[model samples]
Target: MDSHRIIREAEGEVWVSCKIPGKPTIRGSLTSKGISSDEVPEVTASEEFVVQEVTKNRITVSCPEENISCTFLSPYASFSHIHEKNVSYLDISSGGDLGVSSSTDQTFKVWETHNTEVKSVLEGHTRDVFSCKFFPSGQEVLSGGLDSLVKVWSVNDGSCLATMKGHRGSILDIAVVADGQNVISSGQDGTARLWDSAQGACIAVVDDSYSPINAIAVAEVGNAVNLGSPKETPSNREVGTEGKLVVLAREDKSLEGVSLHSRQSVFDFDGSDAFNCCTFISSVGVLAGGLDGNIIHVDIRNPKSAVETVSWSETPVLSLVPFRDTYVASYGNGTCYIPLKGSEQVLQLTGPNRQPVFQVAAWKKLVYTCCRDGFIRKYEIPDLG
Candidate 1:
């Protein structure tokens, strides 16, 4: 019997693929305690191969009636790196190649997503940076900090392009408008303000809510929804912002929706506790998490009650990212859950050393997470087929 290493393991089953000389590679799962001759498919070699044990790097199996060893290597072994300080926020570029992170060390850094090489350190924020995001074009970065200012930086040269100030308190979150021409920010001062990125001026203030907004999500609203026209049009660009709604997770245990153009309250629903994060699963379907260990999914048109409520852990949910056919959420207890829309089984992601996962970002086949442990963990999704 020849030795074959374990390639992938899930549940109680282990899988190994073997490449025999002068024959095609054989892939099969180990059943019972050892491998049977029938388990190896497409192997026409005269040697008898049997798997004994699959360890971290080498597998001891029998090949041609003799024990031999096979080596295994992970493809994603180079995708992990640690930041110098605790990362507070993280975002990946739309192209899935650039990664941006903000830390409690009062600095923001951009790096290559694949190799984890530092591209540039964006410096200028006098206080802790709370929120950072890439524009749709991925050419610039917008960050808001405890200094009560929002700064835009050039991704190419790490130069501060513009700094917009007006918030009386720290900016908690930021949302980029379409085409990177405008942006919106939510602050601890109980306001969500819109800005003109090119002119670096405040376009409008969506201040319908008196509670400090913790998170903000912008989604396109279809023509079916009634988004009234602006009563006092500030700019001709008001038409472009009409068919969108800005969802806000407030510190007062309420989830509010405001029309992006008209600045009118669309709907508001009270949650189990003060909301920490919010996101849009679809144009109409929204999800929000709070301190009471509840994640509420609601429809904006009929948000009088939650469409569904998910409660898996007693810890507060801190972050959320939309995945294929479902959304993944991270909690204060270092637990992450992927709850599908119509399934009872929830996928749990663990490996944070019981530290809080501060933020999560997904791009292509990889999911990136930043934790209080100061490490950015990347997970690769298995091919379903």
Candidate 2:
């Protein structure tokens, strides 16, 4: 791992699909935020997952009004269901097969969800597997965790192909672009690193606001601050265009920016407490909240890149997201949806307090979080008001 990969916070969510007595439940986990080690929970017995399973490559997810869907599993691919238990994390390829990360025996598990069969087991990562995502092509998959190494595995045989060592502590968050040529990661090291997905090389590094990165976002980390690797010729140009990642830095008091292509510090923002997770909405030239009580925005064009403005909050801010080309933030009280374009006012989600929001996964269109009282929630975002 690189010496600079240290961070201070990973205040995001850990997601698992499980079944309660009869209803569906998602054990929301908190990780993937800033550039520092995660803080000790107010209590030590905070759940590690949404549910604890007896078997390694197996999770327990509850379907609404059903006895849990005992379905099929496939090759190195993602499941059709947004959430599944015993499955660490799920990734779907264009082909519809599912790739899953599991900590059962400390291996990445692949399956056919339709039949619920195991395909292959990838071995590595000393601790529980945090997440597993497949390449856009589905030929390979990436897994990360507490042991602090990102392992790339071959989908064909479930073999450990290569490893990218950069973080100094546990790796809590990992995200792959739609193209799969690049990847972004945040951990206890308070910094984020961009890597070449194909060669497994370090491209650029982003300096987080002295906190562990629980979640990360990388698109063109701030206007060519540095191109982490050489420009992608042929299909490689796509590596720098069209795709972007919005990281929810798990910092308690601040946020920063980095160039995934060059791996350099792009900018920073002041925070009151560590942030948890975030996402990029290129449509607005803005990045939103997850940590502090304020929803901060960054100006991607300037050299001294920092937060431009912040929407004040009354509770702990957990996640930031760009929905329908607008901006949204989830907090301890509820969710607030904001429009970035005009003189629009922010919309708040009225609810109870201590809604432990782990992160906002844009792809699922479901704002997933955990309640302080111990119930997981998946807030579905509707396209229409």
Candidate 3:
């Protein structure tokens, strides 16, 4: 045989084909020992075979002529009826026991991680809730809504604890500073604001980009990059805001970095298209997703250009989150991809049938995604640390 091919059709079926020197192409379903060509005399190229083993690291296929193995990732579980409309965003708690989701149905929900049972229904937003996240303590949720308001809710009782208002337009995304004392929010008003979670007051307008901010991520970038000093004395309420970098994804096709303490622009990189989402993969490395499906990886130390650009599809990239050494990205096509950090191998999670997966979150070995199909799918990856 000169060449052979193996393709996974579904959960347990793998298709295999090989070209022989003289005779018709040999095709068969994989058996315990090898491909049983005799048992499947009329096997077509599209027919699926049985794979020997499928795991997080590798997939092994045994054949009489040769053996084939490769890495594969797939979904293992799914949860339905979590919302009535498209689930716009979701975040898993640091404890990995709870999850919170926001949807177009003008509602927010907190659920159990194991079975996705509804724990509490967060109410108060007159419009759609666009973003929601759990605080580090896992006792509260911070949410931004189309009503141009940011609110904090108690996880134990589902009661609205605080309602923060300042932006003139819709609140698009949010980020919590170190601990749970302060939080940052981006809005359609073209500004990012730092707010005291306990007092419900805006500490300062961190940056007014003049372009609608779609998403924001905060991280302690350390002293490697110049964060600039504050022009005025920071308010005493600004807790744990020092040396933090806030990255903004804007509608003007710009990815900008700002100092949380100094409120200074650190760096800016123009993107191929309007940015929709962004996240910090490391202290100094950031990933920004664009409307044109480009995921630009940038190093703050040298922000003149992207370190690398990758695209999984032409569909818009909606959400991004760091998962172990790799990152997870969702798209408008209802697909999620896990691109390994240093390899060409890409794992796919499919279930919503191209209905637009809006957000994805990871906790330990489990991955949870919310889609336009009104379902929250949970995948348990094997051997995932």
RMSD of each: 10.9, 15.7, 6.9
User: Model 3, which residues run further than 4 Å from truth?
Assistant: 1-72
Highest-lDDT candidate: 3
User: lDDT by residue for model 1 over 1-385, one digit each (tens)?
Assistant: 1112233333234443444344555554544343335442122222344554443332334443222333222223323343677888999999999999988766689998878888989999999999899998899999998998998999988999888888989999998888777888999999998988767788888874678999999989776467777788568543357688999999999998888988888898998799999999999999998988789999988989999887656679899789887887888877676653553333445456568888988887777888777778776654321
Instruction: Write the candidate numbers in order of decreasing TM-score.
Output: 3, 1, 2
Model 1 CA deviation exceeding 4 Å by range? 1-82, 237-239
Any residue pairs clashing in model 3, and if so which?
14-49
Query: Model 2, residue 284: what's the lDDT?
Result: 27
TM-score of each model, in listed order: 0.79, 0.54, 0.84
Specify the poorest-scoring 10-residue window by lDDT in model 2: 1-10
By the lDDT metric, which is better: model 1 or model 2? Answer: 1
Minimal lDDT window, size 10, model 3: 1-10
lDDT of 2 by residue, 318-358 (tens): 65656666665656554433333443222333222333433
